[model samples]
Target: MAESRNEPADPIVRGTFATAKQSWADLFKWKQRVAVTNDYGETYCEWQSPRPLRNPISLFAQLSARDWLFFLVGLAAWTADAFDFHALSIQTVKLAKYYDTSKTNVTTAITLTLLLRSIGAAMFGLAGDKFGRKYPMVVNMIVLGLLQVATIYSSTFTQFLAVRSLFGLFMGGVYGNAIAMALENCPVDARGLMSGILQQGYSLGYVIAASCNLGVGGSTDSWKTVFWIGTGLSIGVGLIRLLFPESKQFIAAKEAGGGHTSSSPRAFWIETRKMLAQQWRMCIYCIILMTFFNYFSHTSQDSYTTFMLTQKELNNAAASRASIIMKTGACVGGTIIGYISQWFGRRRAIIVSAIVSGLLIPAWILPTTERSLSATGFFMQFFVQGAWGVIPIHLNELSPPAYRSSFPGITYQLGNMISSPSAQIVNAIAEHRTVTAVDGQPAPAYGPTMGVATAIIALGIAVTTALGPERRGRQFELAKPAGVATADEIEVKGKLNDVESQVAVDGEKPDVGQMENVIVDDDDDDDEKKR
Candidate 1:
């Protein structure tokens, strides 16, 4: 047999700029159905909302027991990564005190961590794709555990920054592997709900880290205790991953000879370059979207506790409590909004959430009392993370079919890289401007700085989301090369030429509804074997 058959090209999808003229008209054209293609082609139709809403439970029931286990494990790994990273962020106050440096200087660790993550994402993400998701993730988590411990040991600010920079590298790889492993096996309709829950792993991490800070007390050295807790979480996730098999989808694709699953170095590079050539546009768009999103979360959150501690004169315990409450709202909103995106359409949900968050910015920071601040912070994160809930699935759908792991991971982290300066900038601006603290002493003007910055970011998120492309239900694992089949896909029903499409002869592409699966995933999992 020939080493490989000719691979079919991706479908023609509209780029963001190409659709700009109709952007205004398209907003009102919600009734139009989204156009889809079997392979990338020369022309395509506009993005639109789907027709009917489905019950979230009914949509959720589509996954097999096997799917649930994999998803939960993926989520655990992601949560651990978040927990490890946020441990440092939530402890910024104590770290500055412990190091006897300015708060702006302490934020340098956060900046270094965020900046290095893009490199880690690119390295580990590609490793997950070319080799397998399991090992890259396992290594990332364990190394992260070590780094957390290292952070606890650092004797100087320079040592701390260096350790955090290393921490960001491993931490960056978790998102791509976790989402690919979690969502690739899920049924199409369940993706929005699941993506929401998965993305909340970050918010959930923040809540837990804040709670850890509260439990450890406000001693300057208490930050190390939180880091210790982070160490346990990271190591624990790494060990837990060791118990699982390779992704069932990865295994299936390999057996079927369908995906770019070749473990060969030569095969991997060839496929990688081709995917980039075809997918560069989608890559740039995802990066730009993620830049705004990373900025959205960091600007509003990283300095929040500091804002409370200084401007509002809340004690550390109170600031931590408010943060927990805020992220709890984030958890709830992400789950609910993610579920709604199933029927509401991904882009629309994001736009509405971003806009609502902008309107809430005034209240989010203006509150002077602990309870009021907690309430506003809670509502603010609900919309903020609710907008974020769509991202995991959105990036996956927009990725090159075979490059899902690296594409989503790289773009998301690159966005993180671009927005890496968020915390430092916020700290810098807050320190310069003066505000009257509750104690009647002059303090850094955190409240107004956060409000103005967040409002601008919220508006940007809304507009960027509106103008971007979405492929809500793209099949990551199922789609095979179009117009070509491996000799292994024995179940393909038509002649090789006819399989190209019955209407291709007339120079017209068939409707997506008329397309066939052509191949089923490897039925080797226990659930499928039992069937």
Candidate 2:
């Protein structure tokens, strides 16, 4: 009877060579039967059996259909955000020219926009956690679209700055909400790819904005036309999202009383306090590190590239064209890095990209002709600046589902808050390097100073890599499984069980509540029925 039960049923397995890799079932059975004997001449079986095979067909089908829709929504939102943000970069120089202001002053407008956007991101993140992602995303799109349209008619520098700053606030909400939507909707196996695809919208938006700037012609009205284009795009995205459904996870959370029900200010604060107290440390660390590196890359590349092009004496038209080219490189680089990170592992990919790009930064400082400078700038932006496209997805994975949006939003915004100032600082430093020649031409004094600053920041990042844990290929869940132990749990359990077994196996007194089985019925059940 034992021989019949143990007989190899599958001929494919029986005919395999001894050196062939073992099947999962064969390996699992072997592991179950093996027991290590201690010095005391006693052996014990491993607790818990292997899990049963899960049905992949149903899981794959559901994830495939749902994640695609989620990806589209994320893509649209991010693309709009990218268009709104990068459109302003080229426009800033134009704004400086039109208002008879210094580029430094114009750069301050960019800083204000970023600062306000960070505020929006943080606020909306909290709101998304409190309420839900869908409403905030829809509201932000409407707000940003209307604001972009309003930006077109601004006459004065203050008006433009105010409008853009307000737009930044709305833009901020889009990111956190969109990310939360994507993260919650995607399957575990495809989260990285979905996140990457969604983030590609930023790069794609840059491309679209650049094309618009170049295609529209760099008149004073050209920037305004670009803003109108952004408004239209945002409206389209908003309308598309209206047709899309809310996240299943979010809906389930709301049904389970895991989300807010009241609108009182005090109640809001209490909920915020609870979230912060529970996950503040992890949230803060991840946000600071990820955002610092992300913003550092973007500000250094996007802002500095425009600065460099203008310094090279390119006209607004030429510079805008060059900016478009740089943005193209960024798009390509972002797409490549996003996909590569999936294969190489997110942390390793980020570290490697940072290191390689850091090495390339010094090249920007090297003396080069206009052609060489443009080529080098494009390469740097594509590889170095593009590396940031993966951080959002990686950061999202590290956070728990309940606090996912809030945590990434806080971390991303806080990092942006710290790093946005670097743009102004870099501009200030670069300004110091400018010298007026005898012929009345302003010459660039520090050719590669921004690159040097970036390299230093990259070095800091290399040191801080230790602070982040490896989350690649790990399943993201609200809580770890209870009875189904992980490897880490098994090790800890073995240590505790060894101690407990020593007493129990030797007929010594057991500790209080040490028995495996314990049952307690709920008194509340009867009381609730009586009530």
Candidate 3:
């Protein structure tokens, strides 16, 4: 006897593992919502389910060459951003000696950088949304390069802190712009894998910093060399961005909105206020999710080198080497887990990775010797960053319509602001407390401190991610105003000048009744397939 329909009714309620499992199956079996805009031009969206996940090559092949350029440049920019920040973090011990201050005091710079990033997120993120992703990022990247050099010449600790604070401000803007540019153009189904590879740019930057640190050997002045390298890298990325055109999605969205990103200050403020009104709850929820993630990474990573030095009794070179390997694991895990998330579902991927990483806390910290510690640390960060891989696409998916740059950027960095003291807190606790080490000697207890904090943070990430909203396979393409040609249909496709002129000539008041395709779809109106 065949059942009348193959699928069960949508779960009456949610928040259970069984429910989540059922929903995962539904992602494949049912027709997911496809975003559609009505004549009123409201942000409400009705979308269809996505096609099945494709191979990495197939997914990548769908992108135009223009898309690849944007993604690669965005990744390069993010990598440079990571290097600039990690230059200080990995050099904490030497910086302490150079400044003649305690490691806790030195981490204050990290705190300041994190604390003020929200401001940059608000300012630059809004600019990216309103103006475009290009110029704001150019300004941010170039300024960041200059700030790194300022870190080199500071004669006093206070001056160093000031420069780093400014650095944080500029740095705050990078993630939002970079991620938006990178993933905004990617295919809906491929974003999971693309996001994973993209996020590893951070880890890649960290690895570059560590490698440079290792090359210079352990010296009080060696950190400056790394900063100089960062200066060049940042400036180079800024220059490279000049060659690329603005994101096609951003263009389509603006054109869809009648030829401007926002036509006037009054309009921009009105839109911002309206978005805030509709999405306040989602905003608060994302901030909470990002808070847990920020804590997860900073607690586990920022002090690990110091932990090895103080508790495990490793030298600077050995510690740096192990760190390189650990983050290498981060790169590998992020890519693999990120790719898998495409088919597995975003929340499920993040939840499982977080849980496994939490369970691996013991193996991560217990090893005594260099080889053993390296192996353990590598495995530990694999899961730590595996969860992180999904963040770029996840945040983009959660962002409100037309505010991708500002919303995700602000929330993410706001989380950073809240968790700014993570490294400082870990250091303050570890430096003062003592626990038995693998050698049976009483040590600063760095391992215990990081382990407990990361475990709690991991659990928090899983729950927050589970409870939050996901818009996987949501569309970023918008309908063209009637009579306006699409990007492909442009006379000189992919040329910046040709596209702008076309937009200027063709974009005008549309017949609201005739308009089709919309980029900014906030909620799925009939998401029965994903239920």
Best model per TM-score: 1
lDDT of 2 by residue, 1-531 (tens): 111222223222221232133222333232222233345555432322323323434434657567668767877888998898878776666767788887778777667777777788878887777667777788889788898888777778888789878877777777777887776777665555455556667777877887888788767656778888999999888888888777766665554422422234565566567756766656666766766585656556556545545465555556656666666676677666765666555665566667777787766656334556667767777766456767667777667555677667767766776666666776677777875432357865434657777787777665455334434544444322111233333444555676578887798876555433211112343356559
lDDT (CA) per prediction: 0.82, 0.64, 0.83
Lowest lDDT sum, 10 consecutive residues, model 2, at: 1-10
What lDDT does candidate 1 reach at residue 386?
A: 96
Cα lDDT tens digits, model 3, 216-302, are: 999899889999999999999999998788889878876763353225566677768887887777788889989999999899999
Point out where model 1 deviates above 4 Å.
Answer: 1-16, 22-24, 32-51, 257-263, 479-531
Indicate whether candidate 2 or candidate 3 has the larger TM-score: 3
Estimate, for each residue in 158-236, the C-alpha lDDT of model 1 and write its tens digit: 8988888888888899999999999997888788899999999999999999999999999988888888898999899
lDDT, residue 239, model 1: 90
Clashes of each: 7, 1, 13
- Give the runs in model 3 whose Cα sits over 4 Å from its true position: 1-51, 257-262, 437-441, 479-531
**Reference-based TM-score, model 2:** 0.73
TM-scores for all candidates? 0.86, 0.73, 0.83
Q: Of the pair 2 and 3, which is ahead by lDDT?
A: 3
Overall local distance difference test of candidate 1: 0.82
Candidate scoring better on TM-score of 1 and 3: 1
